[model samples]
Target: MEQPVHHFSELFEQLGLPSDAASIERFISRNSPLPPNMSLSEAPCWNEGQAELLREAVQEDADWAEVVDHLDASMHKQQ
Candidate 1:
């Protein structure tokens, strides 16, 4: 398996996200799925709520709500 190269702290530092790296990492790790479909695509106009949805959907283990949420949020943010 291809492992993530950096630690969560390093990743957060690079991105300058407001959320704590440990919390984010814990959330991600707990929610992780197999057959990895995880990918995040950003939009310039994306709102925080929308971005959150997109982030959730990209996780390999996301539920149906996450998928629909991402779609709805992305559309709302764009419009």
Candidate 2:
């Protein structure tokens, strides 16, 4: 279940910049490290590491349950 890759084309359009892979990568890596135990749904507040890891987990193209387990962002302790 490969997730469709996300591009920042629309964001670039809105912000009026020429967005590309390098641009997106630079933008992401520019962020600060995030803390563990923080809710990812409230990301940007999350450390850069956590946010990037979460993004990787998502882009891995696994099932949602598998992604949750890997990222440990489960809504339930066990579900």
Q: What TM-score quantifies how close candidate 1 is to the native fold?
A: 0.27
Against the reference, the lDDT scores of all candidates come to 0.43, 0.43
What C-alpha lDDT does candidate 2 achieve relative to the native structure? Answer: 0.43
Compose the digit string of candidate 1's lDDT tens values, residues 1-79: 6434443344334334434756654534443332223334354434576456546645654443444344334333322
Per-residue lDDT of candidate 2, residues 1-79 (tens digit): 6654433444333334446757644544453233455454345534565455555545664333253343233222232
TM-score of each: 0.27, 0.30
Candidate 1: which pairs clash?
Answer: none
Q: How many steric overlaps does candidate 1 have?
A: 0
TM for candidate 2 is 0.30
As a whole number from 0 to 100, the lDDT of residue 35 in candidate 2 is 47
Point to the candidate with the largest TM-score: 2
